[model samples]
Target: MWENLDRPPLDGRALTRALVDGPRGSWSRVDVVARTGSTNADLLAVADTAADRTALIADVQDAGRGRHSRSFTAPARSQVIVSALVKLPGVPPGSVGWLPLLTGVAVVDVLRTVAEVDAVLKWPNDVLVRGDESSGYAGGKVAGILVEVASTHPVVTAVSGVGINVSLTEAELPVPTATSLQLAGAAVIDRGTVVRAFLRAMGSALDEWRESGWDTAPIAELYRSRCDTLGRRVRVTMPGDTELVGVATDIDEHGRVVIVPESGDTSPVAVSAGDVTHLRALDA
Candidate 1:
């Protein structure tokens, strides 16, 4: 861990004090570990009995995952990997779908405020920076969010995991389309600061979402405004290999992306789940 001079280890003690003891204390508990297979999976294991706002962060994730069970990993201390358990006793089932979107917005907010990365949302779960043509970066993905339903009987408990690349170099990226704060020229790259800001931002957003009766209108609007996918020609790949090419028009009340098919014969469709690929930008 000391070998990577540029990548400093997170101050777990400071984090626990600020996030758990500070006036703006939003998390009930925060646990930091040196290594974990997956924070989300580990948190889910205790979600049934853990406190409502418990949080878990790992310095290095050996088997981190994203949407659709895609696996990824980063060098030690090169990313902020965290998972939080949020228990919503009365949240509507449909409203639960927006959890991942809410998480994406929180990540973008933290990256912009703390990292100063000029980040934006890529629909359902990705946070990205506008690629620089000169740098040959085709809008790399800097962070990913994954939300899983931990329980639904007694209460709607959700375990949301987020992974933000902090100081990964070009060669360290898991994929060609992936990027890090260092690669994106962020002003700050402290994992602890990023994690703190993200937790606070997430707590605030979740509070608003709950106060709004899981209305989703306000959250949807906020997400749409920051979403780069809304005004673009996109190709969506749904389950079972179904495909739809269209222009993203809006985010509906249920938090689905409304896609207006390029074909004149088909009507607009609101997709709840799929992989969206941005083909080109379009005027909203």
Candidate 2:
């Protein structure tokens, strides 16, 4: 798989040491694999694993997936793909709504500060950035996050799967709406740096979430501030192929998107799951 001998694979030992050595070290372990079907599936079934903060990094994700089980595949060694497992023993099931949103915040923060790119969250968990102006692309989806939850008798755990486009060039983009860190003029494309920064940010965000008992107000407010979907004319293609065009007004307390139709007096409709597109972005 890794053809580039010069590019180091994710250094699990170094990552674990860095994650566990600091005073704020919240991670219990880091594991790296040469290839895997899906880290989220692997972590969900890791019964022998201890209950703590654990991350699994892979060189090749042959069967990665996104929110709707959409295939998410990138060439080996071209991106930072990782899944972080977090166990929260006492958190109520309702609080789980905050997991994906908080994880998005973490990814956005790392992209902006460490990678020196203006990253924004697209509603649930897609990360978007503006590419170079010369490329004729204003903004493209650069990363994605998926959150899954597994429960044991005594505890509940969440797996946050993240994919960050690191060193891919324009020609290597998986889709026309997607771009990579290198193409976006990121200051660094070190996969290890990106992973470490993401873990640190996730740890901090999880702490804030737990402290607030998964309060939706503060988290929702923060997510709204960084979210690029709000105030945009959007199209939501629902599960049954039904479509609705409206302005994305807000995110309800249930983490559902509020869509106010463009030409109708219909009351706001909150959708739980759908494929969203920025109509204005497409026209731009």
Per-residue alpha-carbon lDDT of candidate 1 for residues 54-143, written as tens digits (9 for 90 to 100): 999998999998889999988999999999999987898878988999899899988888888779999889999888889776658999
Which residue pairs does candidate 1 place in steric collision?
none
TM-score of 2: 0.93
Candidate 2: RMSD over Cα atoms?
Answer: 2.2
Q: What local distance difference test score does each model get?
A: 0.89, 0.85
- The most accurate candidate by lDDT is 1
What is the C-alpha lDDT profile of model 2 across 182-261, one tens digit per residue? Answer: 88888988999999999999998888877877677887887888988999999999989998888899988878889998
* lDDT score for residue 231 of model 1: 81
Candidate 2 accuracy as lDDT = 0.85
Stretches of candidate 2 off by over 4 Å are 47-49, 131-137, 281-284
Candidate 1 local lDDT, residue 250: 91
